[model samples]
Target: MSKLLEVKDLAIYFDTYQAEVQAVRGVSFELDEKETLAIVGESGSGKSVTAQSLMRLTPMPPGKFAGGSILFNGEDLTKKSESQMESIRGKDISMIFQDPMTSLNPTMTIGKQIAEGLIKHQNMSKKEAHNRGVELLKLVGIPNPEKRINQYPHEYSGGMRQRAMIAIALACNPKVLIADEPTTALDVTIQAQILDLMRDLQQKTGTAIILITHDLGVVANAASRVAVMYGGKIVETGNVDEIFYNPKHPYTWGLLSSMPKINNGEEELQAIPGSPPDLADPPKGCPFVARCPYAMKLCENHMPEYTNLSDTQKTACWLLDERAPEVEPPESAIVGGAKVHG
Candidate 1:
């Protein structure tokens, strides 16, 4: 697959009175054509911030681009003018925000919402766009699209609203789709439906997707690759199987361990100790060092460099250093009763 988006050394900071909050620090990742990359991290880990930056969606002044280049379709988005970004946003890349209720215009009919992009970018007539809007709704598995398109967002169920949001995003057939916690507010069944819909859409449109969420279970099913973020940085990245079956970073282990595992009789979920570090004054060394059970002195004094476990897997941790002690992940992190060596 060819590279569609390349975010190089991306950094975003929130300028506050007391300090500059380092929301994202030197984050880099690539999205391939027709592939789903899941950016998994806890709340405030900067995953959402990074996604927002792709389309220059992060608010400036209070939220500044500290550093980095977001290269989409061989152009640098960070340097693009607002006018230039406006052309790219819905036409080339689109976003399905976390909350459809707030993202969608409550007053507008579903057809109008979807038709807005088709009219603006594709220059379709109102009747043409309106017809296409119904097709989009049906494309996303919404029932009775023609009837539903005439109704407002309030008339739709939560899941249906989300589907409408997706329909609006795919209206222009953007090359890239950013779904930020797309299924967070939905129940399990609806979440599955949304995920399946996204996968089906990808198969049909060949649109590369960036799925941002804190859930590893979601990643396991929908993502082709995974990037684990913590303390405003990518601590680990690999294919889905590598991330789930052989994760290297302690943070990744903690996330997996915390997920509720089925068929593991009498096993309680293991939560990671301590909250994420304060980004305003981030730790001097590794951000996760304070909470890591096997943290060594070096881990507290310096941040570890990325170590290539394989061509497809990379992680940053002192434990992966040549001289560090060998330590296995805690039993609680073991998935399906199998160990993941460190």
Candidate 2:
């Protein structure tokens, strides 16, 4: 696998009447060809903002790139003008938004929506694009594609609409696909079907994916790597196994402890105490310090550097310091009945 996209020290901010809100602060990650990277976090943790930044989708004036570079296929996207970005947006890279209902244009027929990109990027004739649209619809598991292609978005079911969105995003055979909460709107069975469809499509098309969601279960099912974001920064990153089985950050522990366990009968899920930090008047030190049960005085005033736990695992926390007291992860953080020693 080769590196297809690289985001270095990316910082996204929103300018408002009150103050500048740091939506994404010094966030960095990479996506390799034919790989799936999951960015997992709660709402307002900057997961969607970070994903949007890759395509330069965040609106300016209110939203601005405060710092850092987004390099796609060796070209710096941050340096590209809107005209230049237009050339790359749907052809080289594409995105599947959270809600197909809101993202899809209501007036256009399903086939026309899918054909728009093909016509724009591939320079296909309307007839050519329409034919490709039917194939794309069929490829994504939509039945009666010939007839369904002529129907409006409102005519399709929720899952079918999402599949249509996928067909549109994948129409150009993009090298990278950014799926922001692709299954968040569907029921459990439909969610599973969507996930399976995405995996199958990846296998067939060889498109690298960046899946953004709050669900750790989805991450476990689809991603090979995980980046845990909180308070506008990536607190921890590792392979799926390391993140789920041997998480290092206190924030990561809190997230894991909150997950529902089937075997732990009668056990209540533990919620992380306190709200996330105010980004407008953001915390000077570690954002998790306010909610961390093991926070030290140092954590209140200073940020910690990322401690490398393995070739692929790293976390930023004062607890990993040699001088700081060693603490064990709470029993509730244990998954699959295995305890992680700190």
Residue-level lDDT tens digits of model 1 in 270-326: 889899999999988898888888888888879898999998899999888878889
Q: List the residue pairs that clash in candidate 2.
A: none
Off by over 4 Å in 1: 337-342
Predicted candidate 2 versus true structure: per-residue lDDT over 211-323, tens digit per residue: 99998878888998999999999999998989988899999999989988878879877899899998897788898889999999999889888999999998999999999
TM-scores for the candidates: 0.97, 0.97
- Model 1 per-residue lDDT at 175: 97
Off by over 4 Å in 2: 337-342
Q: Which ten residues in a row have the lowest lDDT in candidate 2?
A: 333-342
Clashes of 1: 0
lDDT leader: 2
